[model samples]
Target chain A: MSDKSSSRSSGFDRRAFMAGAGIALVPLTARAAVQDPTQAAAQDPALPVEVTLRVNGQDKRLRIDARTTVLDALREHMGLTGSKKGCDHGQCGACTVLIGDRRVVSCLTLALAAEGQEITTIEGLATGDRLHPMQQAFIDNDAFQCGYCTPGQIMSAVACVKEGHAGSDEDIREYMSGNICRCAAYPNIVAAVKQAAPDIMKG
Target chain B: MRSFLYQRATDPGMAVQALSAAAAANNPLTQAAAQPLAGGTTLIDLMKLDVMRPAAIVDINPLARGWSGIETGGEKLRLGALAKMSDVAAHADIQRHYPVIANSLRLAASAQLRNMATLGGNVMQRTRCSYFRDTSYDNCNKRIPGSGCAAMDGVNRMHAVLGTSDQCIATYPGDFAQALIALDATVEITGKSGTRSMPFAQLHKAPGNTPDIETTLQPGELISAFSIPRRWPRSVYLKARDRQSYEFALSSAAIALDVQDGMIRDARVALGGVATVPWRAREAESLLKGQKFDDGLARRAADAAFADAKGRQHNSFKISLGKRLVARALQQASTMEV
Candidate 1:
């Protein structure tokens, strides 16, 4: 609360301490704002990150643009095209994916942030040989037609089951409101989510 | 869609420094316009729509620690800016302690977006002006400075009429802001120049000729948190939107009231999706400051809020709707047991 406390002025000089401790600068914030640098050796753009995604249980390495979105990374790069890009924005949940078992809109998630993270695309819904319970219920309950929004709906449904949100039809609708079914498959989708409630819980 | 460089700052100081340097390096129009990427729930979407075109994205996610979490240690409760809307709503501490703030964010936008967008970004997003978003048009001072505002003469059912000029009339959108203002919260901000803390009232300003200058934040300043003092009170967030969920409010009210034996001790209130800023109904609050929490008092307070309301042709219905929202929110808040 004093002028001394007001201006330590060292809040952003972590590299100064690192050098005094006989450690190399982390280059984290050092080159972050580097402008108009001509030294090719010193101005190497921060290393392009290589991330290995364990989507479901499959392992894959991605040569990703530093700014590549998770939705684009999955759809365009990895070819897990099941997740639709209806909005390519976060408004529509057509690109929902599970990051570390939590459902999120893949389009809004940055791929670089997914480093060392467990991800589950819509393709990872089924148990290899058997269609996942949610997937089967959608078929049984007739939850689609021109099924453009099915993949995202199924992904969110799987999440609802895992997160214990499938208590009732209304709860399913509330939890899955993020997924907009342009085909207006609301009644059937609600029934499908309800039917999968028990099997999803049994697991 | 020209992409320049990207850097994620690990902390507040680093983020401020990076943003300051970038802002200093370029004018408004440059190859290095720096934008701090908060949830990007709206920013990324706007960019895809070609509404905004920032060259550099300064990732503030690393700075999320500085802006998130709730601390209820002192006379005032603190809320971090990065706390997810869903997390804030579900947090037992926030719900039991300050349900108004929590509920406002919870009922805002959609569930998935609530998880992605930060409270800061939610507060700072531009109005949903169709002309602003349309790159094909040459209008919107907020979107393209000095291009002229098409919203002034166009379909402006959602535009702000209380604070308007020939320059612009876009509505100030966001639901969470209404709750903060109603609670008389203090916004804690950090920038390269220094740190400043002030009432949430100071953070927002009315649009005069400069409709593009939306907020009071400096070039490199970042909102770290908000603080609200604890007092014996009941509060509620009332939003009337196109739908019950996943819709922006046409008009919303956040009301906080403290009463004893039916007599009011204090009333702090604000409104959203109505004015140029989160409209604080100080006049209305004064109406109930020393009055009882009865139907008459509620009606008087609500009436006082809109006594000075000026509405555009399309949104004149909001005059009655906004007043009703105030009365309803107050009645709902009063119903909560002390």
Candidate 2:
């Protein structure tokens, strides 16, 4: 997981981005790094450490503080904000992501520890223009309400089907208990998982 | 959230050496100086909340090659410390031989957490007591050491009713530890000096005057593996909670029984969610020796388990709920098709 040489480059790039972004110069990379003042406060106020993550299928180098969670790294640093941070603790599954094909809470996962690991976020679930079958199923079934938790729910549901825990309604509910829906759209969520289970299992 | 140094240990010996060096230099007096990071489920969460602050964190996942196996080949089952909870729970051999272990792990946390949390980390995880986690509460003895225990007189419905001290009433939160104590598991430790093993039951100390000193493990000591003497095929874990899933137990029981001719030949009973430690009900187990494994005997044994239990205002229900769980777990284990 340690790319000894690129660590220095990523640190240099982040400093450059911070310097440019803080000066009101909207460079493409700077714009991507600083979303808002809150995001800037969460990202730039801490000590930056270089970490490498094999995100989706590609190795992405980043400069973040030791405190930046995997969820925040993807959202704040990498500009892939599909994964939501609901509770920021492990209590809610809104920050769920695939680490080496196993689902885990990204909100509780430190980016420093996630080095050299395969991280599949919701944005990585789809190919070119085609939606992943699970994403298609969520849309078809209207499985979400406010949609804040959809990315995490879909990520976990995809894992649930792959893990063979979507055999029945009760099974799906038990396995998907991690991804809590405040909309209480659980019936449709279960239906979406059941609908997508066969196709997910085939893959 | 505080900025701390992070180092990945290439091996168990290196991990010990790093922690020993840090402890010897920084705080030679306390056991909480340096912590080993496994799954980071508990340590990271507590750190995020500012509940726990360690000088350095040694990433121990690299040591998994030496300590992450699930071996069920011998008379005793050997489980490495780095084995994920989900992997251990779903292992075919563990499922068949030790259902209590499997059930306890599978039922403890959510599926995502089970996938991320490690066996050693789970056993070493801290309590879910609100008073301990929230810094706004200034009276948690477990967190601040002699300030006070707010849970004693506050909303303590989730607090321990057994194995509690006047100083602290926080409950031991993990479920798998109950199964470990029930099956007489042993913890293998790797420390700065060398390696040694101890009974799993001896790992956690009761919450006496020094509630701060939770475990008997010395500074810079890391748990390497857990070994169980024998399989309890007729074993089961039953947890009662406020919700059906992803919630900490209100009361739970782990039971293993050896029965012959409708009589219990040997039994092991442990209680969770109602104790200061993973409590072994030795008196209750002795009460069932040579007795018919019936409802009456189970109830009597369950009663014996909680005879010395004392409860506070909101937690008195745990005593009764705990007794019922003991009886129910006994009934389930005794009737298993072993």
Highest lDDT model number? 2
Local distance difference test scores for all models: 0.74, 0.85
In candidate 2, what are the lDDT values of residues A1-203, reduced to their tens digit? 11112323554576577677785422122112112322232332224567778888988887666667898899888889999978887888998999998999998888878888899999899889999999999999999999999999999999999988999999999999998899999999999999989988888
Mind sharing the TM-score for model 2?
0.91
Q: How does chain A of every candidate compare to the true chain A by TM-score?
A: 0.76, 0.77
Ten-residue segment with the worst summed lDDT in candidate 2 chain B? B24-33
- Which model scores highest in TM-score? 2
Task: Give the alpha carbon lDDT tens digit for every residue of B114-222 in model 2.
Answer: 9989999999889889899888899987888789999988999999989999999999999999999999999999997789999999999898998887888877789
Across residues B1-338, which tens digit of lDDT does each residue of candidate 1 receive? 33335666677776776666656442332112567877778776665666666655677876776578878775688878887777777676777767787778877877677777887787887777778767677887877678898877788788775566778777878888888887778998888767789998888767778777777887778888888878434888889887667888888898888887878888877888778788888899888988877888888898888888778768888888888888998899999975
Interface RMSD of 2: 13.7
lDDT of 1 at A196: 89
* Alpha carbon lDDT at A164, candidate 1: 68
Q: For candidate 1, lDDT tens digit of each residue in A26-53?
A: 3322224323222212322232345566
